[model samples]
Target: MVNKILISFFVRRLPEIRRSKGVTRKEIAKGVGITLGKYDKWEAGKVLPKSEDIARIASFYEMSVDEFLGLTEEESEAIKQKLIEDAERLSPEARKIVVDAMTDKQA
Candidate 1:
């Protein structure tokens, strides 16, 4: 029951999130290594992403999959909130440097 609500909310909120983040759908598709049609389907609530794809999308937003799906507990949300605050304190250059370092580490 809860899962269904979360899934519905996630499907509805995804495109809003992307737009709020100022990233194009094409950019999100390329970043997630999915085709634009598939991304569009997910955004349109015509399909649900696989768990792995959900995780990938969550990572792109720098959020946990549970949080991205609006299924996070208060404590988990508080932690994410703190992290977001800290990130927001960084200068754009500093943020880029941190992002680049993380990307390099991932590679």
Candidate 2:
């Protein structure tokens, strides 16, 4: 249920991104090396694009696949909240040390 809703929302985002790029479905299809019908199906939520095709579309739109699908906001926030929770479970000094170690690439 949630998956379907997200996919539908993601499909809707495609056209908005395309218009921002000043391209139509035909233009994006040509840019991404696909059929206009197929691309239209994607935007219409009649078909979900595969990962590779989504990556290609994102590239064509000058955005990452994550951004293209609108995952950057909601998913990123979830991940950040998870990280904060994990950090809180650890000692404060330990948290800073972990961040520093990762930044320093000491591993």
Candidate 3:
């Protein structure tokens, strides 16, 4: 299930990010492989995008999903910590993969 708070944040933040980046809705839609109408609905808060769409949009901005959703620094840190804690319980190989992925994303 999607969190309503995060959805609200995403709705509010997306256009701000786009405007700040000087990009048009049409550009974002084309870049993310979504229709302009769908992007319009998302920007207007008429509907939420699917998770895959959200990820694509974030990637288009070169940001993580959390960053795209306007999560505070503390919230982002907390999520990172939680992921690290969970990864600690995984097998060494699995932990390495998780760490590497995280590192690669940051880079």
Candidate 4:
């Protein structure tokens, strides 16, 4: 499930990020492969995008998902470290899965 707080943060940050990139909403929508109306709704906070769509949009913005969601670099790094620490407590196979997913490389 999507975090409501993250979605709210993303909604508030979307326009700011777009403006900083000097791109229009339509451009972002097209780049991210979402409909312009859907992108409009996302910016308007009428609805949240699916997780995959959120990832796509972040990729389009050339940002990490946390960055795209308005987290500071320190905040993102802290979260990553926390996840890594937590994953260390999991079973070996699960830990490998988590590490691989995070690194996008063989664990």
Candidate closest to the true structure, highest lDDT: 3
lDDT of 2 by residue, 10-94 (tens): 6778888888878988989999889999998888888887544665676677665456656656674564455446656666665
**lDDT against the true structure, each candidate:** 0.68, 0.67, 0.74, 0.72
Q: Which of the predicted structures, 1 or 4, would earn the higher lDDT when compared with the native?
A: 4
Q: List the residue pairs that clash in candidate 4.
A: none
104, model 4: CA deviation in Å?
A: 6.3
State, as a TM-score between 0 and 1, how close model 4 is to the true structure. 0.62
lDDT tens digits, residues 52-105, model 1? 566577778876555566654665556445544555667775455434433432
**Clashes in model 3: which pairs?**
none
- The lDDT-based order of candidates, best leading, equals 3, 4, 1, 2
lDDT by residue (tens digit), candidate 3, 45-101? 778875456657777887775667666777867866776887788777656655654
- Which candidate gets the maximum TM-score versus the true structure? 3
Tell me the TM-score of model 3: 0.63
Candidate 3, poorest ten consecutive residues by summed lDDT = 96-105
Each prediction's TM-score against the native?
A: 0.59, 0.62, 0.63, 0.62
Please list the residue runs of candidate 3 whose C-alpha ends up more than 4 Å from where it truly belongs after superposition.
1-7, 72-107
Prediction 4 global C-alpha lDDT: 0.72
**Candidate 2 — which pairs collide?**
none
Model 1 deviation from native, Cα RMSD in Å: 10.4
Runs in model 4 lying further than 4 Å from the true structure:
1-7, 72-107
